[model samples]
Target: MRLEAVGRRYRARGPWVLRGIDLDVPEGALLRVEGGNGSGKSTLLRLLAGIDVPTTGRITGRPRTAYVPERFAATLPFDAAGYLVHMGRVHGLCGRQAAARTEEWLERFGITGFAGTALDRLSKGTAQKVAVAQALLAEPELLVLDEAWAGLDTAARALLDEAVTERVAAGGTAVYVDHDPRRLAEAVPRRHRVAAGRLTDGPGGADEMARVVIEAEGTGEPPAALPPHSWTAGPAAGAPGLLRIRVPADRADAALRALLDADPPWHIRAVRSTGGTSPSGAVR
Candidate 1:
């Protein structure tokens, strides 16, 4: 998908929140966007997700997308499961399919115990899980996560990390905005920023490593099939017995396969792009 000279503003002559924003979000791309408060980062994401339209110029080639806004109201009338099932049907799934996926995602996010609760009554973390689950229900071609992990618990956050990797591995695009610099410090993703109502290139942070971080918890030696420089393992953060594997992006597929196909399956926790410059403007 591509954007050409896109611009957006509130009124006929109001200050533009975004202008001359040209972007190329290719298939299978993992992109991270960074910017300061009020720098139009959210606006750019909104445009990309089709929540809003450009006031001037053109945007084309948009793909099937799913977006998780930074803040989602939990006061909706429907209960958690009902809302997800309704949204699933809206996204074209049959009632049975929707119910099954809803139950599956709730389980994945550790929220099945609360699936029947009213949305407004659930904890903030549970609400966030619902939001994320709704977005992932359809396996959209384009995934837009705007601070989607803010209220998640440790396991749920790790689940989201895994979800993004699976999407990219399947030749889908996933764009995300997060305050934490280390959110995906292992997946060498393309980085950009919003500044002065425009998307520009500048220094965000250190973008030297082109590696993917794979997490698994088990006892095993690094696979011999992987290039010497393509993989390394260590204890993953926040979880004992979990191993974090770092590998060159080009070799991630093979490395992941080798690890998963080992004699004893290495339970994969998360995989993400790491080492990026997070600043107002991104630089090569």
Candidate 2:
């Protein structure tokens, strides 16, 4: 699957959200899209999924690509199992085959009880699990996810992580968006960031280690108030609302914990680290 020079603009918007984005995704590959909010990562995924057309550029790939967005689309009024079966049928599975596969995915995602319950009645997280199941039921050649990990707890995250790994091992390609660099690194994924209408590997490609860069932003916040060297105050290009902190290759984990414990208003929107050994195995 490939998207070359892809771009999108909403209703004559002044700036392009996705500009000249290009990517080549091969079978069995998992690519993580990392970027700050409004950076157009989700838009790029949507375009690739064929949910929306690109204003410029071209995408070439098999039609079996599937996408799971941040907000799971509401299922028609039906029990969870019914919905799964419906989705499977849409993917071309016959009755018995669809039922068997739905059962397997429901258990795999740990949402079995939801089988008899209405999808709308389930919690947000539970609903997402079904959406994930729907996406995987077809076992598409290419899977695209947008912020799929945001609301999930540790266990759920781990489950999906394993599933994604297994899928790739079975010759499937995936495009996923999430905030966890450590998870992405664990998968040995190819990482890219969408910024200023372009996508780049940004300091690391497929072989580099994962790095997390946290920045403090907001008015009247002291950059020096945080740990020295590990956190610094600076302007991030095209991001005036950000105070950048470039985590050293050796200090990422501890630095991240320190920042989390500190509970600063600033949050890590994207990771800019390549891989290296970290101090005390913290975040290197």
Candidate 2 lDDT, 1-284, residue by residue in tens: 77888889987866788888777776656678888988888888898788999888898875587678889866569888998898889888898988999999888878897799998898888888888888888877788888787677688888777667656544467788887778656445678888777888854564453334555455445444444423334342235655554443444555555555553445656544433333345332
Candidate 1: worst-modelled 10 consecutive residues by lDDT: 275-284
Q: What's the true lDDT of residue 265 in model 1?
A: 68
lDDT of 2: 0.70
lDDT per residue, candidate 1, 1-284, as tens digits? Answer: 89999999989989989988888777766788999999988888898899999999888999989999999889999999999999899778899999999999989988888988999999888999999999998888899999999999889999899888666645577889999988775665567888788786544323532446667766767566755433334522335555555555556677678878887868777777644322121111
In candidate 2, which residue pairs clash? 19-197, 209-275, 211-273, 253-282, 253-283
TM-score of each: 0.75, 0.70
Each model's C-alpha lDDT? 0.78, 0.70
Residue 270 in candidate 1, Cα distance off native in Å: 25
